[model samples]
Target: MTYFNKDIETLPIDKLRKLQNERLQHQVQMIYNTVPFYKQQFDERGLKPSDIRTVHDLHKLPFTKKDALRENYPFGLFTVPVSDTVRLHCSSGTTGKPIVVGYTKKDIDIFSEVIARSLTAAGCQKGMKMQNAYGYGLFTGGLGLHYGAEKLEMTVIPISGGGTEKQIMLLQDFQSEAICCTPSYALTIAEMIEKKGIDLKSLNLKYAVLGAEPWTESVRAEVEAKLGVTATNIYGLSEIIGPGVSQEDFEEKGTGSYVWEDHFYPEIVDKDTGEPVPEGQTGVLVFTTLTKEAMPMMRYWTNDIASLYYDKSAKRTHVKMGPILGRSDEMLIIRGVNLFHTQVEAVLEHSTDFSSNYQLVVKREGTMDSVEVNIEINPELYKGLLKETSLEDVLQHEKIQQAHKMLTKKIKDEIGLSMKVNLASPGIIPRSEGGKLSRILDLRSK
Candidate 1:
């Protein structure tokens, strides 16, 4: 219900650092003693476990990248022996080779505590029946939340994902109070609920912990309106022990997720320079898993870009990371202009009164690069405008022009990118056959 470990969760700044230092020291020793990969890294750097004393000393260690995890494959990074490993989870790398992570029983318990804290921060309580719709299997989202909910004594319905009928049926019959899944899935489920004429008010759902993909505030509002539940963004990666690294405490507005700094240390650095950026400035998120048992990462580059704000009201110094602005690797340069997919999505979020389902198509026309946005407007909204004897068809084109102009200016101001935009009819944009949404399609011959 409340803090799982109240002492640690609310530990004073000085005490928390002390705890972190101890954990960091222990983790370093464990890695040096057991994990060959870390042993080699430390040896190459001429460093010893004792070299890392305070949490700030983490910088002395080399940053871990996704490639390192991939290169290690299944178990090269394990600080503990495989015999002590209790669980294994692999990322759903739709792009290439999947990154695998192993967790000991102690590691799993720590992860559960972190997720439990996330649920509590989002106001989930004991005895509340929660429907966890996040994908389970090798992906850590579903199971991470599943164990956390159970640890918090909340009754959990492990509905995996992608069955709209079953999800609604359980929401009705079980009177589930919360749902956890990707933001896109939440919207898709809301669309299904409306299509099926389900009474959202009758369902006892109160909160939705949505993440796994970048989503806009407009989508959050849409989900809340359709499902009649307060929505919160929960962020994490399989590399950092999923779903509990950071979470938006809705009580604090859109102040971003409050990073659980006790378990994992957080930092923001200039993407190019790799130096620490100012607190309010946007930069790529880097993390160090200070207390993980199976795999402890030191200065792992997360690639996510956002600004970090320290929230003092919570008494626990929580790191508030802005909405994942975009991925560092997803940045595109067109005619000496740099831009990201989230910037395009931000423009769409403000200018479109349509369904949030959309796509960004980037292609090279001759030697010039062009960007086009394909969006779908709701028929009902269009009908309302058409009733005023205003030709909705013509107005749609005007809206497109307006969106294009606003987006072009915004992109130019934000990232110095000049782009072209286009709009498409509702349901025209492609959806992932596997039920997930792909945000970008770069047709540029790389």
Candidate 2:
């Protein structure tokens, strides 16, 4: 219920549109005058800053994609000199070149403010102790959450990420009430608590804001039950000012995440067509930075798949984005069928018997392609089975076999692919050490 900036968050839609229009216009002019990237893109199209007078004219501009960032390298897209940029962050791209982004002091403040708003929405309160597990340095997760938590007036335990043993020790010792980390890492910690037989009363955590990877309702359910907290999603990217572009409200779980539109105006566009889509239709997300001073983005293609709509019954006035279905540019093509891992994740979400943790392994066999899904068995069920039988014999159990068959059939039926589903013993798959977990392994190239 508490808002870091209630005035902007609850601005009337009409007035919000006017503000967005003004900011978008200013951002266009600023970028066109200073950055070669924007100037070149606009000039090539015979466009001028004055041509884009409002958010409605945003479609007239070309999209700034990750390739543009890569082509610009360290500082080409920057509107100001390097000295004016206060801090920098880079994404660990799949290729050799990393996508770098910079922020000015004001940009940093904007980042903190949006994250402050995000934390408040995720059920965090002032004076509450926050154990920030998001990693720091070059990567924006740790410091991003740290500054925001401080702005929110909570006691911040800047523990960073990893050190499973130390994280647990400090959580019990300090009794931090909220945690921030990747969903996979959170699950690893939850599993560790049970496997180590740690006392539940020792932990005082109540809220978790998980992101940097696409997760499902099943993961949320697991984290909530295991950690005894209300887990919500906080979404962002290195290019879009880190983990506060939008956030899911603690009370409104599946409704969507409210985008901080005053700063980041959002539009959903058809991935292939590169045109805006109708409201509620799934497409690639595009954002035009309205207030970023360091490196303002113009219709930056986010690649994230989701639709946006105005949630009439919400605490904020900003448009809400549905849970990211998957990445548009990264969707896998297997045997002529395109799929996102999250689609398979949805199957796991519907099944209460399986663990949310899983990985996709893609391989090519003599002119043919195949997919194998390795999913972790529920820790509680595994632990229970160990009491009666050995780990090897547990797989022979009828319930375990049935669950595996059901999951495989579900994936086939829903995703339209016959993926080989393997139910692994809990803790068999590798977990996130500190950063984002790579969920897919494509061996076709090899």
Candidate 3:
């Protein structure tokens, strides 16, 4: 019911479009005048600043990919002088040169403003305490949420992810009401709470805001039930703005996340043809920053596959985006069946006999690619089985065998592909200490 910025958030459609067009045109002029990359891009297509009069004219622009940022390197894409920008954060450069993002004081403030809107939507309130478990430093999760919480008037823990012991201690001591972290890490914490035999009632956790990786309803239900909180999804990419480009309302969990359109204008385009798709059709999500002062991107392709539509019965006026199924680059084709690991993870969530800890192992058998799913048996289930039989029964146990068969069938039924399933002991699969866990092991490279 509450919004961080109500006036802009609920702005009428016509006025909102007018604002977006004005900002888009200004952004075009600013980038064309300053950044050489955009200058040449415009020149190549003979795109004058006057040509882009509205968001509808966005199709005239070429898409900016992650590689473009890499090709530009550190400061090449920046539209302002070094002295004008206040700070810089960068990707790990794992692929090659790091994609560095600079922020002016105004840019940082806008980042906080949008995140404030996000936290509020995720059931955060003024004076409520939040344990921010996202990483700090160059990574935008920690500090982005931190400043945004401050802006929203909430107390932030600034734990910076990991250290299960300390995180548990402060949750009790601070009586925090909300937590922000990756969904996988939230599951790890839930498992730790079970292993530690902590009293869930003693803690005062009310909400879990999760993102940075694609997750499913199964994960959401598990985290919410285990952590005793309502879990909502928050989406973002570092290129456009760090976390808070959109947020799922706590009340509207499964529906979709509302894109704060006053700042970020969104459009879905066919991945192959690079043409705009009809509304409600799944395609690559693209963004054009409307009011970014330091670095405004035009038609920056996010590569995330999801449909967008206006929810007429929703609380806000902004268009909403469905949960990201998977990134374009992460889609794996095994035996010509296109699938994402999350699709498999969704099936696992339907069964209680399995924990969220699982891995996808991909290998090439001769000329065909094969995927093997290795999921850990729930510790609770394992403990129950131990009381009834010996370790040898794991192979022959009817219930254990049934659960494994059900999981394999679910993958085949839901994901449209048959993957080899290996049910391992509780601790067999690795867990996330703090950061994002690599779920897919592509051994085909070797």
Models 1 onward score TM values of: 0.91, 0.96, 0.98
Residue-level lDDT of model 2, residues 1-446, one tens digit each, is 67788999999999999998888888888998999888989999999989999889988888888889988998998988989989989885768789888999999999999999999999999999999999988789899999999999999999898998899888899998999999999988988887788877889999999999888887898899889999999999989888999999999998999999999989999888998899999999998899999888888899999999998888888999999988997788889998988888778885656777788999989998888999888777877888989878988778888888888888889889998888888778879886789788888898
lDDT comparison, 1 vs 2, better candidate:
2
lDDT of each: 0.80, 0.89, 0.89
* Cα lDDT for residue 23, candidate 3: 85
Residue-wise C-alpha lDDT for candidate 1, range 1-446, written one tens digit per residue = 24556776667778778888887888788888988888998999999989989888877777888999889888888887788999999988887779888898988998898888889888799999999998889999889999999999999999898777888889899999999988888877887788788887779999998888887787788889999999998999989887799887757647778788888888888999888888889998998887888888878898988888876775456567889877888877767766777766665554445667777788999988877666666655555656654564634566545654666676566655655555555556764322357778888885
Clashing pairs in 2: none
List the lowest-lDDT window of 10 residues for candidate 3. 90-99
TM-score of 2: 0.96
A best-first ranking of the candidates according to their lDDT comes to: 3, 2, 1
Where in model 2 is the C-alpha error above 4 Å?
Answer: 350-352, 386-390
> On TM-score, who's better, 2 or 3?
3
Looking at candidate 1, the ten consecutive residues that score lowest on lDDT are 427-436
